[model samples]
Target: MEVTPRLTWNEEKSLQKLLGNVSLRLLYKSSVHGNSFGTMLNKCSCQGSTILMVYLPNNVFGIFVLESYPEMSEHLKKPTTSFLLSFQKNKIMEMTAAFFNSTVDLIDNKLRFNFSQVQYVLLRSNTQNIFIPRLLGEKLGLTYDFKSQYTEYEVFRVEGMKDEPGYINRIAGATPHRDSLLAELRAYRPYADLVSEIRILLLGPVGSGKSSFFNSVKSIFRGHLTRQAIVGSDISTITEKYRIYSIKDEKDGKSLPFMLCDSMGLNEKDGVGLCVDDIPHILKGCMPDRYQFNQKPITPKHPTFITSPSLNHRIHCVAYVFDINSIDNLSFQMLAKVKQVQKEVLKCGVSQVALLTKVNNCNGVLQDNFLQMSESMIYKSQVRDVNMMLGIPKSNILVVENYASEREMDPLQDILILSALKQMTRAADDFLEDLPLETDAIAGMFQLCMRCQLPGSRHLAQTGIADSLFETLLPFMFCLLSLRASN
Candidate 1:
């Protein structure tokens, strides 16, 4: 018997986002089909790509079975793409096999779904031992002994899941261009003659995937998943120490020509995340590696502070990492803090870019094929908003999906990461090429003095030092310019 789907509009939208706009046809409902184990097996068996939803009094949770259920299988089958999804108070939490292994078993006259150490049995007559994992159970407020009699279970067959070509242009080639991108990055060198390696700093709000970006990049180069930097979704920042990470080539095991500097995340509340005042010191490259970040900003008096850091120690490019999902909900205080930090970064003349992470979480189509990021309207709109908010050029903003739950490397994902890295290298090169030579220092100082005589030089006039300094450096500036002209 056919049953009408009880899913709300928002719930349907969320499902489409996860499953790529597939149509759901209700196959069986326990309430209408007598809640018998044999009945569900008969109706749902051999249904390709089914979603089994268990509706409890206050919560709804389910398992998405990517493969068809066999009629009679004594042994369990491991499904690769299946996942567990739970909806609590309209918020969804999806967990894949990366979190825990999942298997489907139809034995002992019961249909069973096993997730790691926990099992869910779908039989009303028999006593169901629904032992949910403690971590997940606590999060969803579910007891270990959840009864099947108190819930309604429904199964829906997913359709129209055939692979479709991306509507938009692919951003980067998956396999063909992956090798070339790797080669280009391996052969890269700093444009600045003074610096051997370029230092790119990652900064963002808590849980913005700054550490995850570094981990993803390392995973690509290391040929496996690397978690050197700690990552979590806690309210406070997980990274306490400022770390400067270098990726090594897997073949030779030598450090790459660039370093990624990671620091504490920025929080809206005061005395929480990275201090806005400390940004200047960090940009100046005075902060030492592994320097502990407390609530207070670092000062010149700090014991480990480098009073005169060389160009090699300074940041060449700053990538402002932002989660695509949370960009719209950014707090005013956070934006103000970012703008405040950007002022200091501009003063240092470092290149800035915005990294829109977690693109998969925002669009289901992109989740399946990340190459279509430019084509996804949702993705494009988010990029536009980020560009507007940060005042960064649209070209400077890159989209990436970090490795969260996968065990192996994906070439599609690698392409995105490599493309972003390539842009960073280019941006760093621009900053390096534009850097003032030591011989031009006197000319730069002269330019600063000339600016002091402008109409809005009231502040310099108030200090009463601009005129005297200008008079003192006047002859030297001319001498430097004359020497340059003669050369």
Candidate 2:
């Protein structure tokens, strides 16, 4: 019989590094599954160094071998001849020859150990219990070739995405609703239409799909797929300048009421991304459009800075774009940066949303049925994870399949893009109504700054109770002053 590579390669309960160049087959497991030892023997035409793995309800595990057993039924009736090797951590802990069904005695009397209280290791595992070296494979009457390799393979029958016919059909049915979704979004007038357009600032780590998001939205309204913004696969920021992209209604050719402003991708390198101090300035419309970013911070004194800008020039909403597949790969420092940036967004009193891109690449069912994109388990998990990481609401986080390579317009793709746009506009409207609350936001930032100046908030909160000694000696200074005056 051939060794099952997948079963033997399991590392949960077995040390696979010890299985170097060994013929390992999972012969038998007590009650989990697979053939019995007796049944397996009948199927094997040739045999030598046959190993038996015995597992019981207790934590004890055993390995016994018959050097030369002509028939499988012979051992069932009289099981006393073969030697048993008990091992763990790739070391021979004990070796004993079985006398009968219930007992075993150590082969070496010098080393004494107790098997009397030991019971079976009833854990379920896929790892093999027997290992026969390749040199011994031929000597054991096994004629199978040990060396065979192939570079190309096929997985035509492999297990994969569950087929949900009902859900899939619903997605197909929703294909025609793209126009309606787009119409509803276009009807939405921004709460604070600054300069007749609601400006949304795009923010995310490099490769987090910030640029691609602008391109996807532009493509949707363009009535054909378009790549207005540069998108790349590299980890560095492809967007060098801060630019604003406006969309027009496809049917009426009227300018859309909203615009997406993209910035240099957020970078982890020191002094690479948008500066912390520049955030407040940008929200207030101090930075002008199409200005290339540099490490140095710009103030209102800069040549391109828009001084004393009105509400039309300011950002009304913020969208944090993240790649669904790359959330786990992001470093901790990047997460801290994201939180810091969110604090700035909260202080600006602007509504925020999260866009998770590359949904098709994450799940096959969604790739096959575009309408079933939201129903995918992977998409739902990514949404939940992004929510937990940045504290975005579950409903506000949108899953979108970007127009990366598709040359033509896809209704399903447009539907998702329009849905996200609608939410952004709605959130922007809510922000305009509460714009006066910006003072409270500023106060919160000041409070945080004060706390950070302290040695530590955690220590300060608990320090009062721990300072009884200082409180006890407080009268000594006043008594010393009184004595000096008398002198």
Candidate 3:
């Protein structure tokens, strides 16, 4: 006997939104085939692109697989482009091949899932929801163990609309390319001898994924999904303190040769978000990590300010994060604030790039394959708008999707993120290469002092020499330092 799909109209609509206008065809139902792992596998085998839904007392959850299930397997199969979905929470978490290989198993006439190294059986109970241990429940975002009987479980084969356009072919050997890109980034070194690590600052409006970008970059190296930074959606900025984040190699635990500095998001309203006046201090590297942002910007009088920041402390590059969905409709005040911040950045001679984030939210086609972002008309127009608005070259603008609700690492996502990071490092190198040498800076300082006609400047001008270069350099250096510090 065949049973109807249990998904409601709203649930089906939400799935289409994520998977891009796909229809679901029921393949198996627990009540019809019996609550046995073998029977369920037999019915679902060879059904490509399936959605497996499990019903609890008050919620529904499932996994969306992009490949067909084999008839039998002692080991788990790789399922790239797959994700876990919770209908009640309206959340979707991307699943990785490595996670799939280690956590799922079919044995003893039951489907088993491993969480925190503990195995729990599923699809074995006909009268009730499968008992989920506390740890497993927590992983599923459930506050308590679910004890209610399972209403039913169903497997559906996802079919795309005939009129829907096909995805751009996956880049050849994209997985291997991801590995190579990771290797390249891991071996990166700063271009300047005086600077051991380049610092890239993230600046953007509130809820633009500024903090989330740092978390995503860190997660790529960590080899798992991590939420070291607090992230949420709100009218106000979620990040209140300036944070300097460093990524560590997963194997040797050595810190990478770059830092990502996060600041409060820019708000259009006065006395909100990141203060525009703080930009100069941040670019010059005077602001300390974990310094709280206030209604007013930091000044030289701030106790936490660094008086003599070194070359390594200064920002090597600035990444302005913008939501792709909202880039077209940016408020006038917000654009003005961004331009004002850019001016401060320009004064310090720092390099800048624009990072367009939340690409998936803007275009449904990108949810399955972010690599196709370049082919998306919507994506291209948004990038163009960002380029025009920021005055950054089109090549310097990068698109990326941050890990928001994933428990595992996806190779495709890694490729996009690492590529963006690679561009940022290259930009930092350019900035370092362009820096004036110490002797040149000193010479320029002397010329400016002579032209200003300070005390003893007339004698120095007449003699074309100074009694002591060191003595003359001292006062000028002090003034320069003071000027730098004040900014």
Q: Write the per-residue lDDT of candidate 3 for residues 357-451, one digit (tens) a residue.
A: 88763333233344444454458888888888888997789888898875445556677788889999999988888887763354355456555
Give a tens-digit lDDT track for model 2, residues 231-307.
85546778888898888777788888888999877776669777766778778777888987889878767898876
In model 2, which runs have C-alpha deviations exceeding 4 angstroms?
A: 1-164, 167-172, 192-195, 361-376, 437-487
Better of 1 and 2 by lDDT: 1
**What is the full ranking by TM-score, best candidate first?**
3, 1, 2
Candidate 3 ranges beyond 4 A from true positions: 1-172, 361-373, 439-487
**What's the lDDT of the predicted structure labeled candidate 2?**
0.56
Better of 1 and 3 by TM-score: 3
Model 1's lDDT to the true fold?
0.71
Instruction: Give a tens-digit lDDT track for model 1, residues 1-487.
Output: 4567666555666565456558888888877876676667677878887888777666677777766765645345755245566765554433332223456666565666666554443443354424345555643445564543336677889887645453111211233456668898999987734366899999999999999999999988887788989995737689988999999999699999999999999888888889888888888788999999998889989998877564666899999999888888898999988888888889889999999888763333244344344454567777888888878998789888898875445555677888899889999989877877641343344335444443323333232222355643554455556567879
Candidate 3: C-alpha lDDT: 0.72
Name the lDDT value of residue 114 in candidate 2: 22
Residue pairs in clash, model 1: none
Ranking by lDDT: 3, 1, 2
